[model samples]
Target: MAAPNDVQISIPKNDIEEQGFKDFDYSQRAQWLRAAVLGANDGLVTIASLMIGIGAVNEDARAMVLTGFAGLVAGACSMAIGEFVSVYSQLEIEVAQMKREKRVGERGEKEEEREKEQLPNPMQAAMASALAFSLGAMVPLLAAAFIVDHKVRLGVVVGAVSLALVVFGWVGAVLGGTHVVRSCARVLVGGWMAMAITFGLTKLIGSSGMQL
Candidate 1:
């Protein structure tokens, strides 16, 4: 009986419920996970390689501990500065892109809307990367601290690094919604290869009577 203009459009309850059940936004998580996993993987590999290389040549506990501690401090600082610079550069590029978009006719509002939805935070990302690196680096350092025997310490460091790499890979995969086992295996192999290379080189150099 109602006039055509008087008829109201009603949204279906299913559609409304579907909106409420929408999957969680994973974009931000992917960003953080990339930075964090990279940081952790680097920290674990670098420190473990350093310790294992040193252990291969010399069995002095003092030397191993000192070297590891130095690597931890130096690596952490380097990672922080590097991450900050990298993220800041990315931010600059994004800003430049936005400016360019704005200069284009009839696309400024659309560009602005898109940019507004997700603005990258360089400072936050840098801090997160640095902290994650430090945390990851501590695993090997702590594992080495408990053992006085240099050879045993080296073994423990390798084990710790392997475990950490697997965990980080799995965590990253889960966060990014990928194949967890494949990611874990990839990281595990990579870490072992790095350590082996470093250890072999150091052993070769030491056996050649080269002191450095």
Candidate 2:
């Protein structure tokens, strides 16, 4: 027997390799990032288009401001509820899969492990989506709130939203390791198209002597 002071240490053959193990892939964050980006894009486009549409016919600052506020509240709530429900559904599917996996395991230990990682947190995903949407919607709201001039306010809001869309697109692209310019251009074009369509429709309706 060895003396009490004497110590023996044994290291596994794969210790060095295990120590160097790293999962640099961002796949785990893909779902949450996609939700966040989509939420923000929806918020920006929807609210901005609504504001522009209202502003095209109604020159009253109060009307535009009120419409924008209502849109923000409604959009945010809708986004939150929608995200929660959608993510919860996905969570249920994962739970079902886990249960199935367990049943499979009970049949025999020789069965290979199927699910390697834990399921995503639906609550976390929902919250992130809602928060991102609210943040995005605030850009146009703030622009309309500060400027009293109707035409100038419209222009400012459009510009601000466009800039925000570009920034958001770039951020998403960077996070997802995509082409920044392509993403930015795509978002910019989509935003402008939404605004243009809304503005044109409202203008046509107003010119047709429709009381709104």
Candidate 3:
């Protein structure tokens, strides 16, 4: 017979894994996490869409590659700058809060050092975002690099982008402790939507006899 005061508890496998990874404190990485995952995803989607959009009107592989390369460079720079500014602002706010709390005086050097160690790093965030953007942007570029055929090139680019989207979404979901299927589906669908809209719009405009 079971004791009346006893209660049963169940811990899921995923929960156990998550708990194991909790040693480092996920909240501390929020700033850099956005820099890496979101930046990479943005780069992948933006450059792929640009290439697809350009490919719609012009079948030339050179044009698509050039546009993608340009977008990747510009996007990477923009992402780095934006991430740096955002993280720097966050760091400033947190530091200000610490000062307001007089944590420095009360906690002494060790505590102050610990607080500093926990602070978000702007340079690190900026670099992570830039590198991540470049990595994501390269997927479509590489896929279309060697293929000269117009239709085939476009198809390959789309396929590569789709795969990259799913991968990025899955990685992000895992890191953020979210539902893998939902995240993958969400990003995959969004990427498809963006590319489809861009391609359709560009094709429609090209068909209208507009000199683009």
Candidate 4:
């Protein structure tokens, strides 16, 4: 039954397993990365635009820094609470789904545990979101905190916010397996528009007969 020209190809089990692991679903990590990216970008953009708006009307470094600080605290807390509630709701729904599917029987114990491992952790997500927001909001606050000259402080905040925006974009892109250049450009342009609009509108209002 043997032929000299016959050949058999065999693949090792180990190699098959390694390939399986390598081809894992990337969407699994998308949930966590989405929260982090959203929190960071929101914190940076909100505080930067707010500070720029104030700077457009007033030259006091103290007021701008204080406002930024207050915003950072409030933002971090809001992000944490929001993420916690959202993820907890998701977790509850998934748990209810497993129960409704009758996946909690004795024979299903192992499978149930495995499925639970994939569920989102509300506390972990909340902490990560809050920390990311605080870290992002700190960029502009630190940039404008020490500088006394209003114009220079404004310039530095803009520069620092720009740099941080690029960094956040790149980091988010890398984590999410996306195009870095496009992400960075989009983030930077959006940030610029927000700052420009806030500064322009606030300036117009201040320059007009609007007292305050």
Q: Each model's TM-score? A: 0.84, 0.82, 0.84, 0.83
Task: State the C-alpha lDDT per candidate.
Answer: 0.84, 0.85, 0.89, 0.90
Ranking by TM-score: 1, 3, 4, 2
Off by over 4 Å in 2: 1-23, 106-116
Which rank order by lDDT, best down to worst?
A: 4, 3, 2, 1
Estimate, for each residue in 59-153, the C-alpha lDDT of model 3 and write its tens digit: 88889999999999999999999989988998899888778668446767855675767688899999999999999999999999999899999
For candidate 3, the lDDT comes to 0.89
Q: Once model 4 is optimally superposed onto the true structure by TM-score, how far is the C-alpha of residue 92 displaced, in angstroms?
A: 1.2
lDDT string for model 2 (19-118, tens) is 6544446676787898899889988988899989999999887788788878878887888788888888987897797788787765444333445565
lDDT of 4 by residue, 74-150 (tens): 99999999999999999999888777667546446765675667789899899989988999899999999999999
In angstroms, give how far residue 59 of model 1 lies from its true place: 0.8
* Per-candidate RMSD, Å: 5.4, 7.5, 4.4, 4.5
Across residues 1-212, which tens digit of lDDT does each residue of candidate 1 receive? 89878979899999988776456566757656777888898888988888889889888877877888898888878877887888789878888888777777547577757777666677777777888887888888888887987778888999988999999999998888778999999999999999999999999999999765
Residue 106 error for model 3, in Å? Answer: 8.3
User: Candidate 2: TM-score?
Assistant: 0.82
Q: Positional deviation of 67 in candidate 2, in angstroms? A: 0.9
> With candidate 2 superimposed using the best TM-score fit, by how many Å does residue 28's alpha carbon deviate from the native?
1.3
